[model samples]
Every structure is written in C-alpha cells, then in structure tokens.
Target: MQETRVAVAGTSFPAVRQHLEEMLPGAVVEAVPVELLRSGGCAAEVLVPAMCRIDAAVIDRVDGLRLIHQWGAGLDGVDIEAASRRGVLVANVPAGVGGNAESVAEWCVMAAIAVNRRLPVLQRVLRSGAAWGDPPGRSLHGRTAGIVGLGGIGQALALRLRPFGMRVLGVRRREDAELAGRLGLAWIGGAAQLPELLRQSDCLFLCLPLTEATRRLIDERALALLPAGACVVNAGRGGVVDQAALVRALESGRLGGAALDVFEQEPLDPASPLADRPDVLATPHIAGVTDSSYRGIARRVIENIHRLHDGRPLLDCVNADPAGAQASRDS
Candidate 1:
C-alpha cells in the first residue's frame, strides 16, 4: 500500500495535520509555508491550501499534484483556469458543512449588532476617559436586515436573527420561492430588487460570492441608497465591495458604520484609514474558521482521499474537466 502524500500550504493549522494523521494512518502531510509556496516548493500528489494564492506559477512546481483542496469555501485566491489547464481538480467544503455556515452566520450577526450598538465608539470613549453616554446605540429588534445572498450562510443568519424579532430580506442570483418561504423571509428576489433591499434595510449583510458580476457590488450608488446611519456587515469576499467607495462613505459620515472580516488587501495595511476609524470594526478574515468547522472540513478531505485511493470521483469537485481529471487520476 502506497502512503498518501498531502501538502498543506499557507496556513499553520495543527488540526489539519493531526486529523490527516489520525484518519489516514500512512499519510504524509507536510506543512508548506507561504514563502515555500511562493517560491514553488510544493511537492505532493494532494495539495490543500488555506488563504494561499495558488496561481499558475505555484501549480507548475508540483509535478504530481492531482487535487487542490481549498481549506474553506472561499476560492477567489485559487486560479481555477490554471488548475483546469494543468489537469488538477479543485474542491472546496461549501457552507453546507453545518459548522462552517453557522460560524460565519454567527460572526455576521455579531458584526451587525456590534456596529449598530456603537460598540467601537463606546470602547473609544471608555479608553479616552470621556463621557460614557457620548454615542447613543440602537438595537436590532424590529429592524430589517438585508442579506445579499440567500445561500446556506444567509439562511443560517436569518434563522439566528429571527429570535431577535428582526425582519430578514434576502437576494440571490436566482429566485427560489420554496427556499424563501421555508426560511420565512420577509421578501426574497434577484439582483433587480437589490436597490429596494438597500433602501429598506436598517442593517445590510453581504454574503455573496466574489465573481465578476459581484465585484464591487456595493459601491457609492448602493451605499447612497441605504437609509441614513445604516450599518453594514460584510462577511463575504472583500472584492464584493468597493473599498475606496466604502472608505469615502465612512470618512464622510455618509454611512453609519461597517464591520468587515475581509478586505481588498488582506491583513489590511496597518496605515489604512479604515483601520483607524472608530465606527469601522476590522477583523482578520476569520468568520468561517472555527474548531468545529475545521473538523468538518477534515472529514470532507478524508472522504475525498478515500475516493481518490479507490479511483472514484472526489466530492465538491469545482473544476470539472472530465478527460483531463481522468488522465491525472490514471497518472
């Protein structure tokens, strides 16, 4: 029996190695740092990357690489075209994994409430020894929350927010009446109804993917549509919102506040103006990263490894080049 070799790039998550070891007894899992990935030192048949930009150059270095398993749902960093051309299948553990969706939804809700309650302002005042009641706060009860995507994460968030007596509105690329009805959404529609959602929502949550259509989906015009002093919580990809426009809105006080887990440039520049604003809450992109989520993702990866060992198709295979994938499998 040949030992399965897995290379984990970019992240230093100990759980990944431990899980792979316990699940695949003879598997060799190497932790490849970001520097090695950048310099093209990935030598493995299976590559699992977390927050590492897997471009054409990196792919070229790994000769026997057959799979690119993303550690999470976000795949904006992976070059799907390059992987497809190189006959490497790309897979991701989507939000359907209960833990991942729930974690992200919880984070989104926390962001919304934190921003609306003016937590940042209160913290600033407390630290500066100023009057405690300088900034008035608001509550989510009876307010409307517009979710930009009606996917698993959005639905989870809606379920969590309902207990607070909040009205949830969702918009997706395609309208699903049954899903909306099941979720008990106030209203759900396609992109055409986004303007209405913006106008009505007291708090807006962005949960959409980062595609060409969704890139900069929340720009100046969209921000202007929001009712004054509206709060924005973005747990989706950073590129989905126009950073410059968002900064302008925050700086000019056109928008009340924002809580962002993702940014246009990750590890957001220390000198970035958005980092300094009292009304803006910036966090390292960690909405979907939790202990339970990692365990769930590990199970998926283990399942895929079993399938690969048995010469069967992998789960959640995003880049489907049947002929090419088959060739790689055979090799």
Candidate 2:
C-alpha cells in the first residue's frame, strides 16, 4: 500500500507540528505554509487549512486532496457552496468556548453593574478624594436576562447565569430541544418578541449569527423598546445591532449602557462615536479568543484528518462533499 500523504495548511503556533506528528504515527504529513497548501506541486492526501483561503477554485489544484480541516468555527473564509458542489468535506471546531463563556459573561455582568450604579462617576469622585453616598446600582440577584440566538455560546452563558439568581428568558428562532427541560429558561416566541424581551430584560445578551434576516435586527426601532435603564451586551455578530442607532440611544440616555465585543467594522475605526462613550465598554473582539481557543484549531484539524483517514464521521463538516473526501479514499 502506498503511504498516505497529508498537508498541514495554515499554521497556528510553532508547537502544532510537533504535537500533530506525535498524534498520527506513520502518517506522512507535510507542514506547509498556508499560502502554499494549494500549490500544484503538493501531493497531500489530506489538506488541513489553518489560515489558508478555501475559495471556490481552491480544490482544483489538489485533484487528489481528501479533506479540508479548518482551524476555527466561522467558515466564512471557506467556500462552502463550491466545496459542497465539488464534494469536499470542510470541518470546523466550535469549541464551545471551553470555559470562555464564563469570562465573557462575567465581563457583560460587570459592564451592566458598572453603568447601573454609575460607578464611573463615583470613581471620579473617589479619585478626587471626595466623599459620596451609595450610587444607585440595581441588584442582579433577581433581574431578567434576555439571551438572543441560543446556540452553543448562548447555552454556555445561560448555564453560568443560573448562579446569579436571574430569570433567563430566551428569544430564539425555535425552542432548543436540549434545553427544553431546563427550568428558569422560558422560550419567549420569535423575532417579534425581541421588543418585549427588551422591555422586560434588565440585561440583554445577544449571541446570534449574522444572516440576511438578522442584519440590523437591533436597529433604531428595537432600541426604543428597552426601558430607560435596560442594558445590552452584544457578544454576537455586530451586524445584529445597529451601531449608529446604538450611539444615538446612548448619547440621548435612552439606553442605559452597552458591552460590545464584536463590531460591524473589526479593528474598530478610531473615530467611531461608540469609542468615546463613557457608558460603552468596548473590547477588541477578545470574548472567545484565548490561547486555549487557539489550540482548539489544531486539535480540531487533527480530529478531522483522523476521521477522514479512518473513514469515520467527519466533525464540523460545514462543506460536506463526497468526491472531495473520497478522492483519496482509495489512496
């Protein structure tokens, strides 16, 4: 039998090569830079794309390539339509936040409390050595937290919120069959209920996807529904909330505050109004990305490669194709 040749595409960290070599014994794996994974000269049975682009035509070069293992959850870079048409199995690792949800949830809760109590103003007084009485901070012990797009991250967040003694109201496209039995979580209808959920929720945490229907889902009209003191945390796609409208609401004091991780424009423009807002706590999209999350890319790649070589089920196959996987099945 001929030896199986696999190409490792897109590098994560320097140690990935050593770890992968030890995991797959006897497998002839070539660690090539992401730019060269698709070069015609490569004879890889399996192509693991880390940061490599898998456009519609990427598969043409690797006529004998079997699988395309991805490093991250979002497959926007990978051309699913082209790969699905060409019969290539694309894999991803959602990784379930790997305890990242707790940190993110903690950040969101802190932002909410920070604004609710007007801690920034109090901090100013404290810095100047001025005395101040209790700032009006609401207790999170019994507030309602509305969670949108109840997916892996959403579920992770909801579970963590349980200890806070908060009422968790979920506004999703449909009821999660898995969390259906869980108490404290009440499914509050569809997108129509977003306004009402906003009115009722003390804090709204959005963990949604970016789809055509979901674009601007939290625009101006939705912002008007929230009570004056309601807070928002968008850990989801930024397109879900309208930035311009959000800034206006924050400026007018119609909305309490916001904690935004992702934004419509990544590496957010310096002059954006939200950046200077005292009520806004904006992070550089670091909610789910950690060293552990980075390793997830490599681990998922190894798992997908093993699945393809062993003829087992491919995990996170976003681009599911037959020939793309079977091309090297015989080899």
- The most accurate candidate by lDDT is 1
Per-residue alpha-carbon lDDT of candidate 1 for residues 18-86, written as tens digits (9 for 90 to 100): 777776788888888888777758678888875678898888877688888887777888899999988
Candidate 2 Cα outliers beyond 4 Å, as residue runs: 1-72, 85-88, 95-107, 114-137, 175-183, 291-297, 309-311, 322-330
Error of 2 at 251 (Å): 1.3
lDDT of 1 at 195: 96
Residue 145 lDDT (model 1): 89
With a 3 Å backbone cut-off (N, CA, C), the pairs that clash in candidate 1 are none
What lDDT does each candidate get?
0.84, 0.69
Runs of candidate 1 exceeding 4 Å displacement: 12-25, 321-328
Cα lDDT of candidate 1 equals: 0.84
In candidate 2 the C-alpha lDDT for residue 85 amounts to: 72
Model 2 scores what on Cα lDDT? Answer: 0.69
Q: Which ten residues in a row have the lowest lDDT in candidate 2?
A: 322-331
TM-score, one value per model: 0.93, 0.73
Best by TM-score: 1
